[model samples]
Every structure is written in C-alpha cells, then in structure tokens.
Target: MMDCQRCGQRNVLEIDHVLPDGTEVKFFFCHTCEEKWWDRDGVQIDLTEVLDIVRRHRE
Candidate 1:
C-alpha cells in the first residue's frame, strides 16, 4: 500500500534516509526502486548506534 515519496509509484516503495550511515538501518523497497536508487543513495546505518540513540531517548 505504500508509495514512493519521490515518484508516487506504488510499484516500488523504499525506505529512504535523509542522512548517510555511521550506524544498522534497514528500509523496505520494492524491486524497481531498489534497482534505481540502491547504489546511488541507500546506505545501511549501524544497528548499535541506532539502538543507543533509541535507548538514550527513552531515558
């Protein structure tokens, strides 16, 4: 049901990060979008850093 934020296409949906990774991050993407943008834009964030941020925010 999700659509691409850029193109508004339902065929492909991906998690897009506004920032580059230093940390584990995963985003969902449909095949078409993945093919187009994965290499150019998407980088996986570190899981530990993400968790640490979440923990700190909770505290």
Candidate 2:
C-alpha cells in the first residue's frame, strides 16, 4: 500500500506500464490529494521528465 506524500493517504492508485521503447514505469495517483506522479526504475520523475520519455519513445 503506497501512501500519499502530501496527504499521507493510503488511497493511492498505481498503474504499471511499459512505454513503446520498453521502458517500465509506474504511475501513481492519490485519491485524497489528487496528486499524480510517475516512477521509473523506482525513482520518482517529474512531469517534464515524463514528457521527455514520451518524446524519446515516439522518435
């Protein structure tokens, strides 16, 4: 059970996915605070980093 960092809520939804380039990622969404974040290889990544991943995969 993952807890929300902002609100300390345990109602965090997680989605594990693989990008087109075979990069694995985990997307986390907090129901309490409505916070969303992404993790790659167990490291938290920012939105800009996520966009970069998408662009790299598309290219």
Candidate 3:
C-alpha cells in the first residue's frame, strides 16, 4: 500500500493494469483525497501519455 501524496493517507488502493501494447503499470487511487495516478517501472506516468500509448497501438 502506498501513501496518498495529496492527503497523506497511508492506505492508497493500487491496481495492476496492462496497456494495449502489453506494458504493465500500476494504478493508484486515494480514497481520502479521490486522487488517481499511474506508475510504470516505478516512475510516475501521466494519463495523457497512457492514452497516447494505447491509441498508437490500436492500429
């Protein structure tokens, strides 16, 4: 469980996800602050980049 950066909550929910290109990532949600973020290879990633990656692989 990771801490929520916004609210400093100690129990952020984490979900593992795979992109359209089969890239693995982790999605985190903070219940307290209603914040969401994605991580790939321990690095933070933006939702727009994730969407672009999916769009590029759709063809």
Candidate 4:
C-alpha cells in the first residue's frame, strides 16, 4: 500500500485512466486528505484542475 504524501496516511488509492491512444495514466488519490496526483514517467503531476475539466466536459 502506498502512503499518502499529503496526509501521511496509509490509505492512498491508485486510479487508472485509459487514454485514447490505448495508453494508461496512473493516478493516486489520498482517502484521508483527498489529494489527487498522477504519475507521468515516474513524475508526479497535480490532477485537480485536469480532473475538473474532464468532469465538466463529459456527457
């Protein structure tokens, strides 16, 4: 189990999103602090804004 970096909690959950190119992006959500981040080639990216846009444009 991965620990949440924001809250130091051990309840970090992994979320996978498949892209149009058949690639997958892995994100982590912290259940304790509600922190959201994505993994891009081993680098962590803040996904709060991106996620908001996606949800807003979805059907």
- In candidate 1, position 32 carries an lDDT of 52
Candidate 1 weakest ten by summed lDDT: 35-44
Model 4, position 52, has a per-residue lDDT of: 53
RMSD of each: 8.9, 1.0, 0.8, 4.1
How many angstroms is residue 12 displaced in model 3 relative to the true structure, after the best TM-score fit?
A: 1.0
Cα lDDT of model 1 overall? 0.49
Query: 1-59 in candidate 1: lDDT tens per residue?
Result: 65555566777655544323332344556655553333223454454655566676667
The residue-by-residue lDDT of candidate 4 on 15-55, one tens digit each, is 77764444457789898899878875566655764565466
TM-scores for every candidate against the unseen true structure? 0.31, 0.89, 0.93, 0.62
Per-model lDDT: 0.49, 0.89, 0.92, 0.72
* Clash-forming residue pairs, model 3: none
Q: After superposition, how far is residue 37 of candidate 2 from its true place, in Å?
A: 0.6
Model 2, range 1-59, lDDT digits (tens) per residue?
Answer: 89998899999999998876788899999999999998999899887887887898788
> Which residue pairs clash in candidate 1?
23-45, 23-46, 24-45, 24-46, 24-47
Per-model clash counts, in order, read: 5, 0, 0, 0
Off by over 4 Å in 2: none
Sort every candidate by lDDT, greatest first.
Answer: 3, 2, 4, 1
